[model samples]
Target: MAPLEPTQPDCVWRNVAGAGKAECKIWQFPTRVSRCTDATNVTGFTWALTQTWQPPEGQVYKLNFDAAIFANLLASVVGVIIRNDRGQVMAALSLKGGVVQDSDEAEVVACWKALEFAIDAGFSDLIVEGDNATVMKSIASGQTDLSRLGNIYDDIHCLARGLRYMEFNSICRSANGVAHSLARYAKHLDEDIVWLEDSPPPALEALLAVSRLRLNEELEFTEL
Candidate 1:
């Protein structure tokens, strides 16, 4: 947690594909950004593998995050997206989770943040959604039955048995507003995390940080 004064990225991005071999590095914090939140909340993982053509049985995991990010004070950013089967967007996650305990660890931290975006977009067939319906019925009732969030729902069903064709559903928070606006723009970053192979980057339009809540509607991070 000492070096990160230039362009940051030294802390995440670990995509490992097996058998046929495929690897991406940057596992330690060094590429950039890491002022250290004083060290504590740590759990970063990314996965994805392929021998040829995997991820296809209904694949679609997109759990949205954003408890309104302080509603007026700003902070809760927890976005997760995984779209497979050629529809593209195989993986995306923007974390900032902070609105105090995040509604009981916000679906066990958005189901281990969609299993670190399905272990880095190995995507073999998954269908997950959120806007929090009890963390999509606690990952479609596979029985993470609480007992202290059963290891984040058993590490999201063991990452859906290392993917090939996974399925978990419960989408409706208005079909998850673009991963809840990138988890309220990842609460203005403290460790700078971004993984865009496609869109939403222009500092997200000066961090719009949405909202409308009378009951539900959130987005945060304001400084611009």
Candidate 2:
């Protein structure tokens, strides 16, 4: 009998004076639907804590390398920890390599620097480790690099060839905590620094932590 008032913002009222009533119609808008897929779901894969820093065998040395990039400053730095089979920190290096285009390039630089360090130190048998699996795999394949990091990769390959034996392996970032921390520390440095038979105080805790791990491991074996 009476015209109904529009109760919603999107509804409009139509005059129906002849019928003695007003009609209100509301338009329905389409709602956006979002589909989110978990990375594990899409690839049918999951990550596990399977990696840890392990000392090399016998006289061989293990070098864990990592790189940190500062997008704001357009610079990158690399950190390397050289440890003997006993897990003793023989030497450490942190280098500020000016600038790099991406994290991949930064990692390449780190690997290259590690190789150079090994060469200078007269290390013949060494194992190079990094958190970047792709870079490690590429280097291990010994393939040509026609990409942006070709020069860096070529240098790495050249240095590696001088070694009696050099093995490149990738580990999870969690396993490379010491090198990762050192890389971050290098971000504020003006130049590269190298320590022999010692590590900077900032990395002392991590070194000690690894030493403790080694001790525990030795004790376990002795008990066995």
Candidate 3:
């Protein structure tokens, strides 16, 4: 047989009958993932959604979340801060209840408040983001075997049903850093919600400064 001639790129050769090398660039951009969730996945969706974000130039979004996240009833706080197309805070929700729990009531109440706020703002469409992936799945699936969460899930659906358009999805913890801060801030407070448009707490500020220093050190190390 004769040798094959070159075709496109400056590479060695193209794969005609055989497979090609597998190399793909991976990026951590957030997007929507639908679900028809069962009972067990209810809480995970709620926590998972906190780490997600969508690009600007989209419709208004309402993220219902808890600051004190309870996976197996542990004391892990979670929060969500959602921004709209205008970059204003569309919703900032945090929660901390007894025994470090995933309080369906907390999620429901927060969802209600956000829904009310969105309605008042006259947003026609919305995307509900959450930290708990399981909760998100349950919401999308339209049912759950969990009694307590089931009730709140119904409430969430009811609220969402009233919306002109809406979506639900999940994200990772690093992606939901802002919301995590807000949730921690909310959980440790003595009284009602605290709104911050300008600054974060002093501890977070210090932590950020330290992080910047570490990054600088890393850059210097790499240069060497």
The candidate scoring highest on lDDT is 2
Candidate 2, residues 99-192, lDDT tens digits: the string is: 7778888899889888888778777777787777567656755668798888888788677666665666545576688898788888888888
Cα distance off (Å), candidate 1, residue 47: 12
Candidate 3 at 126: error in angstroms? 1.7
Candidate 2 clashing pairs, residues 3+ apart or interchain: none
In candidate 3, which residue ranges exceed 4 Å CA deviation?
Answer: 1-52, 62-66, 69-78, 86-124, 144-146, 194-224
Model 1 worst lDDT window (10 residues): 13-22
lDDT of candidate 1 over 141-198, digit per residue (tens)? 5554656667877776666656654444333354456666666666666753656455
- Candidate 1 Cα RMSD after full superposition onto the native fold (Å): 15.4
**Which residue runs of candidate 1 sit more than 4 Å off their true CA positions?**
1-80, 83-100, 112-150, 153-155, 165-224
Ranking by lDDT: 2, 1, 3
TM-score of each: 0.29, 0.73, 0.51
The stretch of ten residues in a row with the least summed lDDT in candidate 2 is 7-16
lDDT of each: 0.46, 0.67, 0.45
lDDT for position 112 in model 2: 86
- Candidate achieving higher TM-score, 1 or 2: 2
The clash count of every prediction, one per candidate, is: 21, 0, 24
lDDT (C-alpha) at residue 216 in model 2: 86
After superposing candidate 2 on the true structure, give the runs of residues whose Cα lies further than 4 Å from its correct spot.
1-48, 214-224
C-alpha lDDT of residue 69 in model 3: 50
> How high is the lDDT of residue 180 in model 3?
56
